[model samples]
Target: MGLEQIKNEFNAIAKTIYFDKAHFLREKASDEKAVRIFLEKVERLLQENDRKLEELYFVYGVFGNLYRVIGHPKKAIHYLQQALCLAERENDDSRKVVFLIRLGEALKYNEEHEKALKTFDKAMDLSDTLQVRKYNDFIFQHKGKCLLELGHLLEAEKCFLEALHIRKEKGDPELVASTELAIELVKKSK
Candidate 1:
């Protein structure tokens, strides 16, 4: 099969998996197990064909998210790092920022606060340089959490406010609530 065909098929399967992503994970007791099984099947197919670096990245992101939800922060970071490396080599700036944000989040949960802060900074820089506002809010949210942990309440509050602005602009009710919660936490802690 041609590379285009392979890419299309891979993307189709990926879209199907991601379509019911939250519902599937929330309903399954062993969500990670189900995700691993699906990934293994896809990986076996990829091994036979060997194509589409971008698809591989999407798969890695899926697994990283699953590992994160399953409480395996180390594995989550590992897969996210792999995705980030591929995204960088491919010059896929959008996915690169997303992976960086995910990696930073995993690192934060792993208690590597300093490294996570640096990672989040890189993501923020990319967002600023690329002018991509959609995922940029994530950098602010994560950075705010890290700063709050570090006792930089004012800085954290600023980050949360920026995130809140983005969420409001995007009309994302859930994120707006989250940003408000972060602001409240920062205020209450001080």
Candidate 2:
């Protein structure tokens, strides 16, 4: 029918499939399979729709996360960088933060702690601009991880404390406890 109708139809199906959500891959095996299938359809849709940059960005993000979980940090970084560039072009602050965080995580897992820290720092700046304290908490947690890896125990502890404060403010006892454990680890490692 019309363009709007086509978009509505795709959006309806997309919500159920969640092909663009990298987090969905962390669910059960069956769910991951479904996500992969949906991803195939999403790829086809992007091709059929002229490979729109917005759609490509989402696809790249999903693939990037998938690669990361599969232990291919290099591939993950490549795809994530693609998504990051698109997010920057669109000026999607929230998505940019997410990409940066995930990119940092991939770098960390790949033993590229210095790069990871830089990415996390960028995320922190964006989180401040966005006023998302939870994101700051996340950034601090990850930054602490990088610092810990770098043998900066004191800095790591400080970062963990900052994360703990934010988590406590958000009333997430579980997160606060986790951060506390991280702090303990820093102390023990020292």
Highest-scoring model, TM-score: 1
Weakest lDDT window of 10 consecutive positions for candidate 1: 19-28
Error of 2 at 9 (Å): 20
What does candidate 1's lDDT look like per residue over 38-62, in tens digits? Answer: 5566557656876567667766786
Looking at model 1, how many pairs of residues clash?
0
For each candidate, the alpha-carbon lDDT, in order, equals 0.75, 0.72
What TM-score would every model get versus the actual structure?
A: 0.73, 0.67
Clashes of each: 0, 0
Indicate which candidate wins on lDDT.
1
Candidate RMSDs in Å, in order, are 5.9, 6.7
